[model samples]
Target: MPKTIDDLSTPCLLIEKERLEANCRQMQARARAEGVALRPHTKTHKMLSLAALQKSHGARGITVAKVGEAEVFAAAGFDDICIAYTVVGAEKSARIAALAPGISFCIDSLEGARQASAVFAGLGRTVRVLLEIDAGYGRCGRTWDDPSLVTFARHVADLPGLALGGILTHEGNAYQPHQAATVMAEARDRMLSVAVRLGDAGLATRGRFVISVGSTPSANVFRNAHRDGFSITEIRPGNYVFNDLTQVNLGVCSFKQCALTVLTTVVSQHRGAGGAVRFFLDAGRKVLTSDRAPLSDTYGQLLYHARTMAPHPHARLTNLSEEHGWGAVRGGSTLTVGDRVRIVPNHACVVVNTQDEAYLVDGDEVLNTWRVDARGHVQ
Candidate 1:
């Protein structure tokens, strides 16, 4: 029973309660003011308590990247959930059947849609399915500019057990300032073109089919475009709730807005080559998950001088092994072994997934310890 933040073991996840509530409130307000629904992607935190916080802040629905995550959220009383990944396999499809009727999900290929239709139709269930558009990520889904997108959407709508719910995209590659503008613009133009064509075909319309886009780096663009009366009906930014170092480097959110962090202790320290102060933190790839800022080698930043909330002036984790992180700071020799610190991971999504549970803290006090109910649902 870790009674306080200081009592917690090293290399554990922590969430600042006040900052998290603020993040959720602001994002929900942004979506509301833009006349679009805020459907937060829950893969970021994977905590049921945080998801409830998002829902209380007026999130219309929640988004998950896998069928298993959807099941976790669904079993927890989340009625409106969207599985935002192209699900595969019989076990996954059968799992979808249990979430039928109100469940919404994404698909990029006809064969996948056909398999879903076969299972759903056999079970006398029709699931809401969204066509996923690859907005320059190259991960999955048809490219936003794919010429066959409209025809493909029509074929999906024609499936007996699939309801054409909407179109969605994740601007995952829009991390840098240079890529943000171009990728966001491309998403708007290409998605609008596809939606308009689908409307023309009478299979789906803007009045009927939703147009959604997500990515914390492009959140402002999502709001502005929707406010300017674009076809966008929903925004699914996930990492906004716990803006990580990645969001900070991209200028999406400041460090203060970051609600999630890894608490660790300096187990060892020494003077390294060139007489720089080097330290080994108890956290490493297993705890922080080794995701760097986009296009950069920085593993993460440490809150130094025994200040869990004050970022060190220059210290950064440059390398990591399984259970140790190598860090060095210039002109800093006061750091000692056993000094507690907090680390801001480059990406928060992977960090939370690595933890079995997280301690919710307000200042030095542990408000509550919550299980990561939706963690590790990668099916």
Candidate 2:
């Protein structure tokens, strides 16, 4: 027998459907106003239903971080997808070639381009390849000023079975800023400048040169700064779908709009010295992610019941082990065991990895459940 929303087990992930729909619409509207295609990254939710909702809200396509993720989405009917990772190795290259007829993959090194070209040679099909540029994030991308970048692009263009699809970058460093506005402006400028440089090198004139940029903190800035000649045709942000404690601490979103939360039952309550009340919950790093950025310390944020769904100002998560979370309630108020509480994780992506399925809830009512099909696809 399948379990409905309400009859499920505790210490589970719950997603508010209405809030998720609102977030999808908000990003879609912003993409429309900016005249850029929204290709939201599916690594956040990893659920086909949410991806469909994004498409219905005017998204051109979706983005995935790994080949397995792309396969999962493609099997779910997302054909026009982009795998935003550097292609390498024969196994991955074969998978990329197999997916070439339906989706696109990114390339950053000459060796990867050559491998991709060799793998797709016999099908008479040209794989759409995007030259990844190193923005502020020092991740896997060729440096913008690397003299060999144009040579590599030309090499990829000259290849018999490959088509240079333009440049892509993830400005992930923007999340470290003290203010959202400043980070957004800098990330937008960096991406736009790279796109212009790629165009100046005659990359866009060949065909549909997709200049993709993304990261939730930077998407808002890109939307405001869109213009012609920059060639920024797509944006691929993932975390916007389920805002988390890190985003809230960094001022990216508020607590109310957060869609994902882990519902845990209070297992124990004891008294500490100096008349302090200690509360322990069954949820810990195993349920809530411990992947906190520089902004937050605890594994997740504790939500206390009030008049509505507001987080209690004095409620805070003080410590966390593998399977236990400890916290202190202000004023030493007593809390009985078996009480239910909701915890907002520090990082939504990591939380998605922790659960195999999540409940779709609306207000206080449970709606349905969806499998996290693309979990653990780290490659």
Residues 232-285, candidate 1: write the lDDT tens digits. 788899999899888887777788898888888889998788777899999989
Pairing residues by index, what is the TM-score of model 2?
0.93
**Model 2 lDDT per residue over 199-239, tens place:** 67776652367778888877866645644555467789898
lDDT of each: 0.82, 0.78
Q: Global lDDT for candidate 2?
A: 0.78
Least accurate 10 contiguous residues by lDDT in model 1: 221-230
Q: Residue 124's C-alpha lDDT in candidate 1?
A: 83
Which residue segments of model 2 deviate by more than 4 Å? 1-6, 224-228, 273-275
True lDDT of residue 253, candidate 2: 78
Q: Can you give the lDDT of residue 162 in candidate 2?
A: 87
